[model samples]
Target: MLDHFENDMVVINDDANSDSVQTDDSSRLTTVENPTLITTTNHQVVKLQLNATSSSHTKCCVCRENLRDHAVKITFQDRDFIFLSRNIWIPEVARCCSGHLINNLLSKEAVDQNKPFSIRYQELSSSDVQLLLRKAQTLIEMARKDLVSMIQEILMMMNVVY
Candidate 1:
């Protein structure tokens, strides 16, 4: 009787093992093999740096004109990170002009004709700045995932089982 029970247990364990292997296989099938690699070539990095530095000279989104002389300057910090590698990217948007004043003027002209002259400057709130940082982080995460997946696929192709 004990021998029969032991045999049953062994069958049960084998069934469980098979089920787990099937589950793992199905899960792996859902993942794309050798996903596209994220390339950060030196030229791309230089382009990004140039864009960051020249953002101030770009036309203001609201006014569609080059920044005025002596325009109030605003700065925002952006960050990026990769998971497969230990690289941190922190880019700065410098000397950008705020457009809130022009918006306010237009709105006030429509609402009250005799209002005192006043201008509002649109400044990035702490939360808005945080959002920018979060975006960078997300990009980095995507790059990292792509890199890790590519490395994994390469290892598999080499018959590396780990």
Candidate 2:
């Protein structure tokens, strides 16, 4: 198992008490050809998908267990948030056990359990970056609306009490 990856891979296996990484040379790295898969380098994640689940997913990417009929697609916000907060990169099309998610999103425990099994060279696409930007924009819009509504409610209360 480890023999195959020893050539062009960096494998990291981490437990609660210890962390181990093995690499022959960082400079000579091979590209992951699967367009729908996720890989991580030390600094960043590459090829993150921002939309729709892939039907080809048969196992949970996190647990690697044979998925039942109830497997759910991970959301883009949860995927990006994990990468942002924990540096755990999830494939855009990765599916997971329904138990791993709360309301179709990755939970703190789920993110914590997600460690980079293999390290591949980073490759970012323009569409991936643009999709991330769009997700951020949508979040900002929602936040702005919430703030306005909260402020309006406060003003109403103040006027009524005055």
Worst 10 residues of 1 by lDDT: 1-10
Candidate lDDT scores, in order, read 0.33, 0.60
Per-model tally of clashing residue pairs: 0, 0
| Tens-place lDDT digits, model 2, residues 41-152 | 4332244332222223797766777899888888867777766555566666778888988877777787777666554344565445567677667767888999988888
| Weakest ten-residue segment in model 2 by summed lDDT | 1-10
The residue ranges of model 2 lying beyond 4 angstroms of the native Cα positions read: 1-56, 126-162
Pairs that clash in candidate 2: none
How accurate locally is residue 92 in candidate 1, as Cα lDDT from 0 to 100? 36
lDDT of 2 at 71: 86
Which stretches of model 1 miss by more than 4 angstroms? 1-123
Residue 122 error for model 2, in Å? 4.4
